[model samples]
Target chain A: MIEFIQALRDPDIAFLRYAMAAGLLAGIAFGIIGSFVVVKRISYLAGSIAHCVLGGIGAALYLQQVYGLTWADPILGALFAALSAALIIGVVSMYAREREDTVISALWVLGMAAGILLIAKTPGYTDPMSYLFGNILMISSADVWIILILDTVIIVISMLFYNRLQAVCFDEEFARLRGLNTRMLYLLLLGLTALTIVLLIRIVGIIMVVALLSLPAAIAGQFCGRLWQMMIAAAVISMLCIAAGLCLSYSLDLPGGATIVMVTGCIYLAGFSVKALRR
Target chain B: MMPQPVISFNNVCFAYDQTEILHNVSFNLFEHESVCIVGPNGGGKTTLIKLILGLHHPASGSIRVLGGMPHANSRRIGYMPQSTHFDPSFPISVLNIVLMGRLGRRPGSFYSRSDKAAALQALAQTGLVDLAARPFASLSGGQRQRVLIARALACEPELLLLDEPTAHVDPAMEQQVNDTLARLAHRLTVITVTHELGFVSRMVDRVLCVNRTVKLHPTSEITGEIIQEIYGSDLKMVRHDHQCSQQGHTHD
Candidate 1:
């Protein structure tokens, strides 16, 4: 613990501070968007979008290496991929011309396959593991700034649409009857979830993104009786998990993302058991 | 000659992909009238309600609501669904659920003071004002039904539509709901869709029997033959004192 604090202050290890800041800043969006994702029961949709981020990251890396496009940042690639996946999923699920689960599952697998193929074709020996399971310690100062901006955008937009989103999540038919363009609102929700997933990719990567996104909200759902309260509680729980996980990883020489997910999972299990026993 | 009907269906016909749900259905519901839409399951009772709410469009014919296109005046209509399909563990409060009735065409917004006031008033009308702060999932089956009704009322609509309001509710809760609707019937046009014949006879001025087609009869004119026609010969009718026999308007 003492070494971790010293590492936090060390100028040579500024990446530690950046990682910490990014995780905590990203936690706010994680909590808010995750609550909606969980309550709306669209975690499967979120999982697909998160996985598609890899296809973008791989494509961006390949573009930068092959075509010498310096501006094609992987994060930008992730944002593009996530948004595209969200729109396609939103439209397909809304129309439901085909079975929703079949389409989502197909997209989920296709995204991962596309990402792997793109990464394999890239010239340099890039480690997919680092992106597959995130390495938060690699986050740069620029990453922190991007996280901050995305975080602010998410919080503002969510707060602005709190009531409408609540209505959409609760009863879409009622919302439509009330003259709300429910389809548009549903698409907007997907768009926001895409952005949130992009932010989460850097913290826990694609595979474990759903865990971090859902666990805190699930834990909060056990105790809180309101969506806003659940969001606030989830955000706090997420930050605590990230902070503790980071310190534990630093001290114990463990992978940061996995450690954080483990901590969140443990807390959720504990909460679930307590609630069950009380009943 | 007459005040405009709150809802008018002109030779309306609706069909699912291959099956015809409602055929040549026509009706005129006036202002401040309580009408019950009754039929057996799959008899297009819900399809009729959906047509009025503009959730589904008819394959042919015209439907007018509040003197405009079906959905054009949707804001003036309040709707309570048969049952809300939601996650049982959802953390919304009763007040928030009711406040959703005030949702308008705005994209992203908060509930205003007037919206909250209107929601509270609707809750009071449903006799659930004290439970407004409680979690919606914590309410009983009857209370939940009333909360949904309150949500509909929260819109302060001129036309209120309820689908099976008494279904799944206990006798005591059904009584409370009946009383609430009885009071609401005096002010606005109430259209209820139900399978309960007793509810139809007691609460509505008229009954619209739907079974692939539409038939309107005054509550007193609902003979056993009419019931048989609507329900078909597959099911037997349980004649009660409230039932209409060969004798017209039997009081006992």
Candidate 2:
């Protein structure tokens, strides 16, 4: 832990600072949207969106490595894929005649499958594990800036439309009766969740993104009495988890994302157990 | 000229896919009238309310609310649904839930001082002012029902629509809800969809019995026999330990 703290200040290892900054910045978005996802019980939808991001990452890698497209950053591709998946799922859940669960399941698997196949075909020595499970230490200064910008946008919009989103999530039918355009509000929520999921993909990777997104907020729900309180608590919890996980992983030489997720899971389990025992 | 009906449903018919839920249903509810909509489980009681709220469009006829199209005048109506679908573990205060009643004001805008005042007033009306800071999930079933009622009242609506307000409440809480609705009925046009036969006599001036079609009867015209005859043994009446028609209304 001491070594990890020293590493953050070491000029030679600026990546450590970038990784910490990125994780903390992205945690704000995770906390805000994850509370909605937990309260609205849409973690399943978020999981599908998170898995779909790998497809975009793989496609970007393929295009950049094989076709030599200079602008094909994996992050941009991830944003595209997350928003597209959110729209498709949103439209299908709301308007499509097809079964909702079947579509969600299809997107969940097909995205992962396409990503693996595309990664396999991308020329020389590309490690899929690094993307499948994130390596926060690999994040650059540019990634930190992107995370900060996305975080600001999410926080602003979420606070701006807090009451409407709360109304829509709590009782959609009643919200519609109040003439709140609930359908559009619902789509907007899913869109915000998509953007947050994209930021989450950087710190936790696609496989464990939903856990990091939902766990802190779910834990916060146990302590806070209101939605905004839960958001604030969850964000603080998320940043603490990231900081602790980074220190532990650095000291113990373990995988960063897995360590972070395990820390979150342990806290949730501990809280659950304590509550059960008290009862 | 006669004053406009608060809600006018003109030969309205609603179908889900090919199944006809409500066929050629017609009714005119006037201003300040209290009506109870009662029927069997699948008798389109809720579908009628949906049409009036403009959540669903009729397959055939037009519906008017507050002298305008249903959707256009939706802000003038307050609704409390049978059940609010949400996670019980959700973090929301009773006051915050009630404030949702004032949702028609622009999306990006914050709740005004009047909105908060209105919510607190509604809470007071439902006898829930003391519980305003309480978590909505922490409330008992009856308290939650009243909170929903307060939410509906907070809209300051011209017409209030309540779907099954007393379904799961205890008798004591049921009486409280009855009192609240009775008090509100004096000022606004109130429509409640309930299956409780006793609620018909105690709360409203008229009963709107809906099957595939709708029939309006004055409260004096409703009896245990008429209900049994209309519902065909499918409707279960909550008799409160008395034999059917023990309240002195004859079967015939």
Candidate 3:
């Protein structure tokens, strides 16, 4: 514990500031996206995408182990796989019958299996378990910049298309009839959701991302009377969860992502209980 | 010469897969009249309303609202879905739901003070001003229906299409909704699809009894014989369960 705090005290890891900043930024994105995911009932989708990351990492690691391909960034490989699946599910939803849910669920498992298998095949290259859960402490400056940029872009796009998103979420048919071009909107939202899962991979871990995306919104639903309020409330709760988890991890020397998710779950349970009691 | 029908349906046909929902439907709805589509369950009454509101396209025929295609004039029509279809668990205030009527007024526009005032006024007009701040999910059946009516009115519509406006409210508020429709008919060209034959018979200027095909009757022509011909069952003392009725009204 002393070494960990001492490590933080080190000016050599001066970039801890950036890691926290990026984590907060990513938290904002997750919170906003999480708001709609709760309203539209897509937390399961978030979970599926997170688990699918294992497949992406696994493939990248396996290729590097067997063929001597660079494993420097296995997540990129995971990202490719995750994005590919996201797009496939997106297309299937339009053309197929009630099978998009099934496809997404299938990909969730497949993504995990593929990642674990590739990791097994690969020559040991830095335990990829961190990627599955996440390693916030080890986040690179480039990773921070990428997360900041993605969150900023998502925020701007959300603001720019705020009305359109609102229209789409509340009444899709009414939105389409109003000349909103709903098909393009659906793809865009799905793509953004995929990107959000990818961004959250480092801080919250793939397995725990669903909690980050769902807990705040579920709690916020009680207080928020509108979409924008709901988003803000989620963001606030998420930041608190992130901060509290980091503090607790610092004290307990535990896995940060799991700690954060556990904190969020507690908040969710407390809120759920209070709500139920009030009812 | 035609008095420029506000809504014109030229041989409109709609089907769900193989079974036809609306077959060779044609009609002209004028600016000054209120019309209702009355039919049995699964008889395409809601389908006709959807075609008018541009929520669904006809299978083979063309539909025009206010001299343009339905989609083109989406801004001109205000639609209130059936009360049975509204979601009780939806997280929104009566005021916010009402303001949604202005969503199509302009794309990417912020709600102005005038818009706020208009929503408030509509709520007041529908006797829902007291419930405006209440969460929609917490409202009683009658009040929720009133909020939706307020939502439809918030648009200041030149044309209004309601699907079963009174299908969930108590018999007391059902009359209130019917009265609100009666008032709206003076300004907007109102076309509602309903099963409330008792109230619709008096409030609507015309009625369209729909099944696979449709039969349009001027209000003056409707009689006991026509009801016997269409429903094949009786609405004489029947009412939809308010609890089950409010299940998915917003989904409409």
Highest DockQ among the candidates is held by which one? Answer: 1
Write one digit per residue (lDDT tens) for candidate 1, span A96-163: 97589899889988888888999999998989898889998679999889989999998998988898
Q: Tally clashes: model 2.
A: 0
What digit string (tens of lDDT, one per residue) describes model 3 on residues A1-279?
465557567778754555566667788887788887787676777678778878877777777777778854765875777677667766777777666788878888888887777787777755767876777777888888888888888898888877677667766665665456777877677777778888878877778788888888888987777778888888888888887777677678888889888999998999889888998
Query: Native contacts retained per candidate?
Result: 0.94, 0.85, 0.28
Candidates in order, TM-scores: namely: 0.95, 0.95, 0.86
DockQ, computed on Cα atoms, for candidate 3: 0.34
Look at candidate 1 and tell me the lDDT of residue B10: 91
Q: How close is each model in CA RMSD to the real structure?
A: 2.3, 2.5, 5.8
Computed on alpha carbons, the lDDT of every model, listed in order, comes to 0.89, 0.87, 0.77
Tens-place lDDT digits, model 2, residues A173-256: 788878877888888998999998888676778999999999999999998999999999999999999999888888898898
Q: Which ranking of candidates, highest TM-score first?
A: 1, 2, 3
lDDT of 3 by residue, B6-30 (tens): 9888898998889888889888878
Per-residue lDDT of B1-252 in model 2, one digit per residue for the tens?
A: 987888888989999999999988888889888999988889999899889888899999989889898988888888898754556777999999999998886544699898899999999999999999999879887898999989988988888999999898888888888888889988989999998787777757778999889999877778767798668966666665333222333444
Models sorted by DockQ, best on top: 1, 2, 3
What DockQ does candidate 1 have relative to the true complex? 0.77
| Docking class for candidate 1 | medium
